[model samples]
Target: MSQFLTQLGDAATAVEAFLAECLAEQQANGTPPRLAEALRHAVLAGGKRFRPFLVFESAKLFGVTREAALPAAAALECIHCYSLVHDDLPAMDNDELRRGRPTVWKAYDEWTAILVGDALQAFAFELISEPGRHEDAEVRAGLTHTLAVASGAIGMVGGQMLDLDAGRLPEQPAATIADIMRLQSMKTGCLITAACEMGAILGRATASDKAALKTYGEHLGSAFQISDDLLDAEGTAADVGKATGKDAAAGKATLIGLLGIPEAREHLDRSIDAATAALHAFGTKAEPLIEAARHMGRRGS
Candidate 1:
């Protein structure tokens, strides 16, 4: 577990450097000064960078070099940062703090936050589409397409819409566990699955290998969300680096809300088990991912 955390930290550092370089290039190319600063603030506000680690580790499974995988990892991080920016807006989750600092909206303004998200979203595709991302144009295109589908209306955004709609209609029936699962899958799971899928694409993985990673990602994503819900229910705002208890406060339909903490914890363990099981074909080569799944179940923040 310590080794896995170290590797995760290394991946985060590498991806952060790549992101900083990309932002610098954009700035040199005449991006507005304030906009560039805000972009840096949003993208460089350190987090676990778990999605990029997934990209790097998944690509490594197929012998893809870190150099070849860096662009795609950076691109995926862009989308994630963009999502954070938008989700923190007053019109959305209305979060004031993110990663233990004021959110983009709170630090700047609503208009800047909105534009930062839009720019980051567009920049993600630009990074993925770059010739340097992959030697094969098709691979780059595949990564771009997968990322788009994952972050778009049918994925994260759609999930956010469902989340906002939950309990908004007093006349409507309460959301079931399945409904909550679907919502979380689209909102959180899609991008995570895409991160792994994009790595598979970068490495030109076999269909079977890709499918395996997809299954692993799905289960891992589920465990991640449940852990998040548990954290919100039980963790402190200081420890979580953001507001806690907001999910319950907002009446959001979560697996924890449906199953209660004990059952939800059990479900989280099952999800981690399934995630690691999906990597059986990769043998010891997939130990990092297996550990990652376990870490998701036990994450403190």
Candidate 2:
């Protein structure tokens, strides 16, 4: 466990360095004054950078370099940051803090926050669709499309909408849990699953391998969402790097709210077990990625 954690930390360190570089470039390339600053703050906000780590470590399973997966990882982080920017708006979750710092909207003005979100969203695609980044144009397009679908109305946005709707209508039924899961699948699972699948695709893995990775991603993503809900109930702003208990505070319909803590933790563990099983075919080929799944299911941040 110690060696595996060290390896995971090494990959996370590599991704953090890349992300910091990306943030610096964006910081230096600002056009206006505060707008660029807002964008920078949004991008540079301290977070786990887990999505990128998954992409990098998963690619390593096939002996691929981190550079090969860097763009996708960075692109996914951009999308996630943009989502937070938008999600924290007064019109949305009305958040004040993110990553233990002022949210983009709170640090800047509403207009700036909105534009930063828009620009970051655009830049995510730009990073993925950039020519010559990938040998296969189809792969680039597909990856970019996957991001769009995940972050767009059909995905994250739709999940947010459902979240708002669920808040309005309490006492959600069992089918409501399914709806919540669907929303989360697009909102959260889509990007996470893409990270694994994209890494495999770039590594030139077999179709069977790609399918297996995608399955692992799906279960891991679900586990991540469950863990997130549990964190909202159990964590603090300092530990989570975001506001705590916002779901219950906002009357949001989370798995924790409905399933209770014991049930939620059980679901998360079960999902982790399924995710671990999904990698059985790869044997040692999937160790790092399996570690990543366990990390998400157990780690707090």
Task: List the candidates' TM-scores in order.
Answer: 0.94, 0.86
Residue-wise C-alpha lDDT for candidate 2, range 119-141, written one tens digit per residue: 88888887788786677888788
What C-alpha lDDT do the candidate models reach, one value each? 0.90, 0.79
Please report the candidate that would top lDDT against the real structure: 1
Summarize candidate 1's per-residue lDDT along 1-301 as a digit string, tens digits.
Answer: 4887999999999999999999999899999999999999999999999999999999999999887899999999999999999989998878999878999989999999999999999999999998865779999889989999999999999998888778475665678999999999999999999998988999899999999999999999999999998887777445545454777667666577679889999999999999999999999999989999989877876
Runs off by more than 4 Å, candidate 1: 167-170, 236-244
RMSD of each: 2.7, 3.8
Off by over 4 Å in 2: 1-9, 19-30, 169-175, 235-244
TM-score of 2: 0.86
Model 2 residue 198 CA deviation in Å: 1.1
Which 10 consecutive positions of candidate 2 have the poorest summed lDDT?
Answer: 235-244
